[model samples]
Target: MSIIPSIFGGRRSSIFDPFSLDIWDPFREFPIPSSSDLSNETSALVNARVDWKETPEAHIFKADLPGIKKEELKVEVEDGNVLQIFGERNVEKEDKNDKWHRVERSSGRFTRRFRLPENAKMEEVKAAMENGVLTITVPKTEAKKTDVKSVEIKSLESYIQVLIDVLTAETRQNRVTPLVSVYEESCYRKISSEFL
Candidate 1:
Protein backbone atom coordinates (compact mmCIF):
# COMPACT_ATOMS: atom_id res chain seq x y z
CA MET A 1 0.00 0.00 0.00
CA SER A 2 2.98 2.30 0.45
CA ILE A 3 3.72 2.32 -3.28
CA ILE A 4 1.70 4.79 -5.39
CA PRO A 5 1.80 6.31 -8.87
CA SER A 6 3.66 9.60 -9.16
CA ILE A 7 1.97 12.77 -10.55
CA PHE A 8 4.34 12.46 -13.54
CA GLY A 9 2.35 9.33 -14.48
CA GLY A 10 3.36 5.65 -14.59
CA ARG A 11 6.42 6.18 -12.37
CA ARG A 12 6.00 4.42 -8.98
CA SER A 13 7.01 6.28 -5.84
CA SER A 14 7.41 5.21 -2.21
CA ILE A 15 8.17 6.92 1.11
CA PHE A 16 11.94 6.50 0.67
CA ASP A 17 11.90 7.92 -2.89
CA PRO A 18 14.42 10.71 -3.53
CA PHE A 19 13.08 14.29 -3.81
CA SER A 20 14.80 15.08 -7.13
CA LEU A 21 12.71 15.18 -10.33
CA ASP A 22 9.81 13.52 -8.47
CA ILE A 23 7.23 15.41 -6.37
CA TRP A 24 5.34 13.51 -3.66
CA ASP A 25 2.16 15.31 -2.71
CA PRO A 26 1.26 14.80 0.97
CA PHE A 27 -2.49 15.34 0.36
CA ARG A 28 -2.75 12.67 -2.36
CA GLU A 29 -5.28 10.72 -0.35
CA PHE A 30 -7.97 13.33 -1.17
CA PRO A 31 -8.77 13.19 -4.87
CA ILE A 32 -9.24 16.44 -6.77
CA PRO A 33 -12.92 17.09 -7.42
CA SER A 34 -14.41 17.06 -10.93
CA SER A 35 -16.00 20.07 -12.67
CA SER A 36 -19.43 18.91 -11.53
CA ASP A 37 -18.35 19.22 -7.91
CA LEU A 38 -17.39 22.87 -8.42
CA SER A 39 -20.66 23.83 -10.16
CA ASN A 40 -22.82 21.68 -7.89
CA GLU A 41 -21.51 20.52 -4.53
CA THR A 42 -22.64 16.88 -5.04
CA SER A 43 -25.55 14.97 -3.45
CA ALA A 44 -25.03 15.73 0.24
CA LEU A 45 -25.57 19.51 0.21
CA VAL A 46 -25.40 21.08 -3.20
CA ASN A 47 -24.18 24.66 -3.65
CA ALA A 48 -24.79 25.80 -7.20
CA ARG A 49 -23.00 28.59 -9.05
CA VAL A 50 -24.80 31.90 -9.61
CA ASP A 51 -23.98 35.02 -11.63
CA TRP A 52 -25.07 38.60 -10.88
CA LYS A 53 -25.15 41.63 -13.14
CA GLU A 54 -26.28 45.25 -12.91
CA THR A 55 -27.73 47.46 -15.62
CA PRO A 56 -29.32 50.91 -15.84
CA GLU A 57 -32.78 49.39 -15.39
CA ALA A 58 -32.30 46.60 -12.85
CA HIS A 59 -30.10 44.10 -11.06
CA ILE A 60 -30.16 40.63 -12.62
CA PHE A 61 -29.13 37.26 -11.25
CA LYS A 62 -28.69 34.03 -13.21
CA ALA A 63 -28.43 30.73 -11.34
CA ASP A 64 -27.34 27.52 -13.05
CA LEU A 65 -29.80 24.77 -12.20
CA PRO A 66 -29.49 22.01 -14.76
CA GLY A 67 -32.27 19.41 -15.06
CA ILE A 68 -34.44 21.16 -12.48
CA LYS A 69 -38.18 21.70 -12.87
CA LYS A 70 -40.17 24.79 -11.92
CA GLU A 71 -41.83 22.86 -9.09
CA GLU A 72 -38.46 22.04 -7.52
CA LEU A 73 -37.24 25.62 -7.23
CA LYS A 74 -38.03 28.35 -4.73
CA VAL A 75 -37.26 32.07 -4.82
CA GLU A 76 -37.96 34.56 -2.05
CA VAL A 77 -37.10 38.01 -0.76
CA GLU A 78 -36.68 38.51 2.96
CA ASP A 79 -36.47 41.68 5.13
CA GLY A 80 -36.81 43.91 2.05
CA ASN A 81 -33.18 43.55 0.91
CA VAL A 82 -32.08 39.92 1.01
CA LEU A 83 -32.81 37.96 -2.15
CA GLN A 84 -32.89 34.18 -1.58
CA ILE A 85 -32.74 31.38 -4.15
CA PHE A 86 -32.95 27.74 -3.15
CA GLY A 87 -33.90 24.42 -4.80
CA GLU A 88 -33.17 20.71 -5.02
CA ARG A 89 -33.14 17.96 -7.65
CA ASN A 90 -33.41 14.40 -6.41
CA VAL A 91 -33.00 11.22 -8.45
CA GLU A 92 -35.46 8.35 -8.08
CA LYS A 93 -34.25 5.32 -6.13
CA GLU A 94 -33.55 2.25 -8.20
CA ASP A 95 -33.80 -1.45 -7.40
CA LYS A 96 -30.80 -3.53 -6.27
CA ASN A 97 -30.26 -4.81 -9.82
CA ASP A 98 -29.89 -1.29 -11.25
CA LYS A 99 -26.56 0.43 -10.70
CA TRP A 100 -25.50 4.02 -11.33
CA HIS A 101 -22.18 4.20 -13.16
CA ARG A 102 -21.99 7.96 -12.59
CA VAL A 103 -24.18 10.09 -10.31
CA GLU A 104 -22.79 13.58 -11.04
CA ARG A 105 -26.02 14.75 -12.72
CA SER A 106 -28.06 14.96 -9.50
CA SER A 107 -27.70 17.33 -6.56
CA GLY A 108 -29.37 18.17 -3.24
CA ARG A 109 -30.80 21.40 -1.85
CA PHE A 110 -28.76 24.62 -1.59
CA THR A 111 -29.63 28.16 -0.48
CA ARG A 112 -27.96 31.35 -1.73
CA ARG A 113 -28.69 34.88 -0.52
CA PHE A 114 -27.73 38.26 -1.93
CA ARG A 115 -27.98 41.67 -0.28
CA LEU A 116 -29.71 44.15 -2.56
CA PRO A 117 -28.89 47.82 -2.63
CA GLU A 118 -31.26 50.49 -1.29
CA ASN A 119 -32.35 51.36 -4.81
CA ALA A 120 -33.60 47.80 -5.50
CA LYS A 121 -37.37 47.60 -5.99
CA MET A 122 -37.96 44.39 -4.09
CA GLU A 123 -41.75 44.57 -4.34
CA GLU A 124 -41.59 44.33 -8.14
CA VAL A 125 -38.89 41.66 -8.31
CA LYS A 126 -39.53 38.92 -10.90
CA ALA A 127 -38.06 35.49 -11.57
CA ALA A 128 -38.19 33.10 -14.51
CA MET A 129 -36.63 29.73 -15.22
CA GLU A 130 -35.76 28.65 -18.75
CA ASN A 131 -33.17 26.45 -20.44
CA GLY A 132 -31.65 25.22 -17.13
CA VAL A 133 -31.08 28.80 -16.01
CA LEU A 134 -33.06 30.80 -13.46
CA THR A 135 -32.97 34.51 -14.08
CA ILE A 136 -34.15 37.04 -11.51
CA THR A 137 -34.52 40.74 -12.14
CA VAL A 138 -34.98 43.43 -9.51
CA PRO A 139 -36.03 46.77 -10.93
CA LYS A 140 -34.27 49.84 -9.55
CA THR A 141 -35.28 53.41 -8.72
CA GLU A 142 -33.21 56.51 -9.36
CA ALA A 143 -30.72 56.99 -6.53
CA LYS A 144 -30.58 60.41 -4.88
CA LYS A 145 -27.41 62.31 -5.67
CA THR A 146 -25.60 63.99 -2.79
CA ASP A 147 -25.07 67.78 -2.89
CA VAL A 148 -21.40 68.44 -3.72
CA LYS A 149 -20.14 72.02 -4.11
CA SER A 150 -16.77 72.54 -5.71
CA VAL A 151 -14.28 74.76 -3.89
CA GLU A 152 -12.13 77.30 -5.76
CA ILE A 153 -8.40 76.58 -5.89
CA LYS A 154 -6.53 79.66 -4.59
CA SER A 155 -3.24 80.83 -6.25
CA LEU A 156 -0.20 79.15 -4.56
CA GLU A 157 2.29 81.78 -5.86
CA SER A 158 1.53 84.22 -3.02
CA TYR A 159 1.94 81.50 -0.40
CA ILE A 160 5.18 80.25 -1.95
CA GLN A 161 6.59 83.82 -2.07
CA VAL A 162 5.73 84.35 1.63
CA LEU A 163 7.32 81.04 2.57
CA ILE A 164 10.48 81.87 0.63
CA ASP A 165 10.70 85.31 2.27
CA VAL A 166 10.29 83.84 5.77
CA LEU A 167 12.93 81.15 5.06
CA THR A 168 15.45 83.62 3.60
CA ALA A 169 15.29 86.04 6.60
CA GLU A 170 18.32 86.09 8.90
CA THR A 171 17.96 83.79 11.95
CA ARG A 172 18.74 84.76 15.61
CA GLN A 173 22.37 83.70 15.96
CA ASN A 174 23.51 80.20 14.69
CA ARG A 175 20.59 78.31 16.31
CA VAL A 176 18.71 75.88 13.99
CA THR A 177 15.00 76.63 14.58
CA PRO A 178 12.33 73.95 14.21
CA LEU A 179 10.75 75.84 11.28
CA VAL A 180 14.13 75.96 9.51
CA SER A 181 14.57 72.18 9.96
CA VAL A 182 11.05 71.55 8.64
CA TYR A 183 11.71 73.69 5.54
CA GLU A 184 15.07 71.95 4.96
CA GLU A 185 13.45 68.50 5.21
CA SER A 186 10.67 69.52 2.79
CA CYS A 187 13.23 70.90 0.32
CA TYR A 188 15.29 67.68 0.55
CA ARG A 189 12.14 65.61 -0.07
CA LYS A 190 11.15 67.73 -3.07
CA ILE A 191 14.67 67.47 -4.58
CA SER A 192 14.82 63.70 -3.98
CA SER A 193 11.34 63.22 -5.48
CA GLU A 194 12.34 65.13 -8.65
CA PHE A 195 15.33 62.75 -9.19
CA LEU A 196 13.21 59.65 -8.61
Candidate 2:
Protein backbone atom coordinates (compact mmCIF):
# COMPACT_ATOMS: atom_id res chain seq x y z
CA MET A 1 0.00 0.00 0.00
CA SER A 2 2.91 2.38 -0.47
CA ILE A 3 6.11 3.08 -2.42
CA ILE A 4 3.94 3.12 -5.53
CA PRO A 5 3.17 -0.60 -5.59
CA SER A 6 6.73 -1.26 -4.45
CA ILE A 7 8.27 0.96 -7.14
CA PHE A 8 5.76 0.42 -9.96
CA GLY A 9 4.14 -3.03 -9.98
CA GLY A 10 1.90 -5.49 -8.11
CA ARG A 11 -0.40 -3.17 -6.17
CA ARG A 12 -3.61 -2.30 -7.97
CA SER A 13 -6.53 -4.40 -6.79
CA SER A 14 -8.83 -2.43 -4.55
CA ILE A 15 -12.12 -1.16 -5.92
CA PHE A 16 -13.46 -2.68 -2.71
CA ASP A 17 -11.83 -5.97 -3.78
CA PRO A 18 -14.58 -8.45 -4.61
CA PHE A 19 -12.03 -10.82 -6.12
CA SER A 20 -10.88 -7.81 -8.11
CA LEU A 21 -10.70 -8.61 -11.84
CA ASP A 22 -8.57 -5.62 -12.82
CA ILE A 23 -7.12 -7.83 -15.55
CA TRP A 24 -3.50 -7.27 -16.55
CA ASP A 25 -2.26 -10.81 -16.73
CA PRO A 26 1.30 -10.56 -17.99
CA PHE A 27 1.24 -14.34 -18.28
CA ARG A 28 -0.83 -14.80 -15.18
CA GLU A 29 1.75 -17.20 -13.81
CA PHE A 30 1.27 -19.90 -16.44
CA PRO A 31 -2.38 -19.77 -17.46
CA ILE A 32 -5.40 -20.46 -15.27
CA PRO A 33 -3.73 -22.74 -12.79
CA SER A 34 -5.46 -23.61 -9.52
CA SER A 35 -7.75 -26.23 -8.06
CA SER A 36 -5.37 -26.86 -5.34
CA ASP A 37 -2.71 -26.48 -8.04
CA LEU A 38 -4.07 -29.16 -10.39
CA SER A 39 -1.02 -31.13 -11.34
CA ASN A 40 0.33 -32.89 -14.44
CA GLU A 41 2.64 -29.96 -14.31
CA THR A 42 -0.26 -27.57 -14.44
CA SER A 43 -0.89 -28.19 -18.14
CA ALA A 44 1.29 -30.73 -19.87
CA LEU A 45 0.97 -31.67 -23.51
CA VAL A 46 0.20 -28.18 -24.70
CA ASN A 47 3.67 -27.24 -23.64
CA ALA A 48 5.08 -30.29 -25.28
CA ARG A 49 4.75 -28.63 -28.64
CA VAL A 50 8.00 -29.30 -30.47
CA ASP A 51 9.09 -28.69 -34.02
CA TRP A 52 12.19 -28.98 -36.11
CA LYS A 53 12.49 -29.47 -39.81
CA GLU A 54 15.21 -29.79 -42.37
CA THR A 55 14.78 -31.67 -45.59
CA PRO A 56 17.17 -32.87 -48.22
CA GLU A 57 16.49 -36.37 -47.19
CA ALA A 58 15.12 -36.01 -43.69
CA HIS A 59 15.54 -34.71 -40.16
CA ILE A 60 12.10 -33.69 -39.10
CA PHE A 61 10.19 -33.73 -35.85
CA LYS A 62 6.88 -32.45 -34.68
CA ALA A 63 4.94 -32.85 -31.51
CA ASP A 64 1.67 -31.77 -30.04
CA LEU A 65 0.60 -34.99 -28.40
CA PRO A 66 -2.91 -34.32 -27.23
CA GLY A 67 -4.53 -37.25 -25.51
CA ILE A 68 -1.27 -39.11 -25.91
CA LYS A 69 -1.32 -42.74 -26.84
CA LYS A 70 0.64 -45.28 -28.84
CA GLU A 71 0.81 -46.76 -25.47
CA GLU A 72 1.29 -43.40 -23.85
CA LEU A 73 4.16 -42.24 -26.02
CA LYS A 74 7.91 -42.63 -25.77
CA VAL A 75 10.72 -42.69 -28.30
CA GLU A 76 14.45 -42.82 -27.98
CA VAL A 77 17.98 -42.93 -29.40
CA GLU A 78 20.19 -41.99 -26.50
CA ASP A 79 23.95 -41.25 -26.54
CA GLY A 80 24.93 -42.45 -29.98
CA ASN A 81 23.27 -39.11 -30.72
CA VAL A 82 20.54 -38.32 -28.24
CA LEU A 83 16.91 -37.91 -29.35
CA GLN A 84 14.71 -39.07 -26.53
CA ILE A 85 11.09 -38.00 -26.07
CA PHE A 86 9.06 -39.07 -23.13
CA GLY A 87 5.52 -39.10 -21.79
CA GLU A 88 2.88 -39.41 -19.10
CA ARG A 89 -0.40 -37.67 -18.40
CA ASN A 90 -3.15 -38.74 -16.05
CA VAL A 91 -5.39 -36.33 -14.21
CA GLU A 92 -9.10 -36.64 -14.67
CA LYS A 93 -11.00 -38.55 -12.06
CA GLU A 94 -12.06 -35.87 -9.64
CA ASP A 95 -15.61 -36.18 -8.47
CA LYS A 96 -17.53 -35.18 -5.42
CA ASN A 97 -20.02 -33.21 -7.37
CA ASP A 98 -17.32 -31.91 -9.66
CA LYS A 99 -17.42 -28.12 -9.63
CA TRP A 100 -13.98 -27.08 -10.86
CA HIS A 101 -13.73 -23.77 -12.72
CA ARG A 102 -10.55 -23.78 -14.76
CA VAL A 103 -7.60 -26.00 -14.22
CA GLU A 104 -5.76 -25.63 -17.52
CA ARG A 105 -4.83 -29.08 -18.85
CA SER A 106 -1.71 -30.78 -17.55
CA SER A 107 -1.51 -34.08 -15.80
CA GLY A 108 2.17 -35.01 -15.64
CA ARG A 109 5.15 -36.60 -17.36
CA PHE A 110 6.71 -35.01 -20.40
CA THR A 111 10.18 -34.68 -21.78
CA ARG A 112 11.92 -33.90 -25.03
CA ARG A 113 15.48 -33.92 -26.20
CA PHE A 114 17.47 -33.78 -29.38
CA ARG A 115 21.08 -33.54 -30.49
CA LEU A 116 21.47 -35.86 -33.42
CA PRO A 117 23.50 -34.61 -36.36
CA GLU A 118 26.65 -35.84 -37.99
CA ASN A 119 24.47 -36.38 -40.89
CA ALA A 120 22.15 -38.26 -38.63
CA LYS A 121 21.05 -41.71 -39.74
CA MET A 122 20.59 -43.15 -36.37
CA GLU A 123 19.63 -46.66 -37.32
CA GLU A 124 16.95 -45.30 -39.59
CA VAL A 125 14.81 -43.48 -37.09
CA LYS A 126 11.10 -42.94 -37.66
CA ALA A 127 7.89 -42.47 -35.68
CA ALA A 128 4.36 -41.41 -36.32
CA MET A 129 1.19 -40.53 -34.50
CA GLU A 130 -1.27 -38.36 -36.42
CA ASN A 131 -4.42 -36.59 -35.18
CA GLY A 132 -2.50 -35.20 -32.25
CA VAL A 133 0.68 -35.09 -34.20
CA LEU A 134 4.00 -36.65 -33.34
CA THR A 135 5.81 -37.50 -36.53
CA ILE A 136 9.56 -37.93 -36.46
CA THR A 137 12.15 -38.99 -39.02
CA VAL A 138 15.86 -38.73 -39.17
CA PRO A 139 17.73 -40.10 -42.08
CA LYS A 140 20.49 -38.25 -43.85
CA THR A 141 24.05 -38.98 -44.83
CA GLU A 142 25.92 -38.46 -48.04
CA ALA A 143 27.00 -34.89 -48.11
CA LYS A 144 30.59 -34.36 -48.95
CA LYS A 145 31.51 -32.35 -51.98
CA THR A 146 34.28 -29.81 -51.99
CA ASP A 147 37.12 -29.27 -54.40
CA VAL A 148 38.41 -25.91 -55.52
CA LYS A 149 42.01 -24.91 -55.79
CA SER A 150 43.73 -22.39 -58.02
CA VAL A 151 46.76 -20.22 -57.40
CA GLU A 152 49.78 -18.77 -59.22
CA ILE A 153 50.29 -15.06 -59.44
CA LYS A 154 53.66 -13.41 -59.45
CA SER A 155 54.83 -10.53 -61.65
CA LEU A 156 55.19 -6.77 -61.28
CA GLU A 157 58.88 -7.59 -61.44
CA SER A 158 58.42 -10.29 -58.85
CA TYR A 159 56.80 -7.72 -56.65
CA ILE A 160 59.75 -5.46 -57.18
CA GLN A 161 62.03 -8.25 -56.18
CA VAL A 162 60.18 -8.94 -52.96
CA LEU A 163 60.28 -5.29 -52.04
CA ILE A 164 63.99 -5.27 -52.73
CA ASP A 165 64.58 -8.18 -50.41
CA VAL A 166 62.73 -6.63 -47.51
CA LEU A 167 64.52 -3.33 -47.90
CA THR A 168 67.81 -5.10 -48.16
CA ALA A 169 67.12 -7.09 -45.01
CA GLU A 170 66.14 -4.07 -43.01
CA THR A 171 68.95 -1.89 -44.37
CA ARG A 172 71.59 -4.42 -43.46
CA GLN A 173 70.94 -3.75 -39.80
CA ASN A 174 71.24 0.08 -39.99
CA ARG A 175 74.12 1.03 -42.24
CA VAL A 176 73.37 0.63 -45.97
CA THR A 177 71.90 4.05 -46.87
CA PRO A 178 72.72 5.44 -50.29
CA LEU A 179 69.00 5.62 -50.90
CA VAL A 180 68.82 2.03 -49.78
CA SER A 181 71.93 1.16 -51.66
CA VAL A 182 70.46 2.45 -54.91
CA TYR A 183 67.18 0.66 -54.23
CA GLU A 184 69.03 -2.57 -53.60
CA GLU A 185 71.10 -2.47 -56.75
CA SER A 186 68.19 -1.72 -59.07
CA CYS A 187 66.14 -4.45 -57.41
CA TYR A 188 68.84 -6.97 -58.02
CA ARG A 189 69.11 -6.22 -61.74
CA LYS A 190 65.38 -6.47 -62.22
CA ILE A 191 65.17 -9.76 -60.35
CA SER A 192 68.24 -11.22 -62.06
CA SER A 193 66.78 -10.33 -65.47
CA GLU A 194 63.41 -11.95 -64.66
CA PHE A 195 64.92 -15.33 -63.92
CA LEU A 196 67.27 -15.22 -66.94
Which is the leading candidate under lDDT? Answer: 2
Clashing pairs in 1: none
- Give the clashing pairs for model 2: 40-107, 40-108, 43-105, 43-106, 44-106
| Residue runs of model 1 more than 4 Å from their true location after superposition | 1-45, 96-99, 145-196
Deviation (Å) of 196 in candidate 1: 45
Query: What's the lDDT for all of these models?
Result: 0.75, 0.77
For candidate 2, lDDT tens digit of each residue in 45-142?
53687898989998999988877776788899998888888888777898999887556666677788989788999889999998988899988998
Cα misplacement distance, residue 117 of candidate 1 (Å)? 0.6
User: In model 2, what lDDT does residue 71 have?
Assistant: 76
Query: Residue 84's C-alpha lDDT in candidate 1?
Result: 95
Count of clashes, each model: 0, 5
Candidate 1's displacement at residue 171, Å, is: 50
Error of 1 at 60 (Å): 0.3
Taking all chains together, each candidate's TM-score versus the true structure is 0.52, 0.27
Best by TM-score: 1
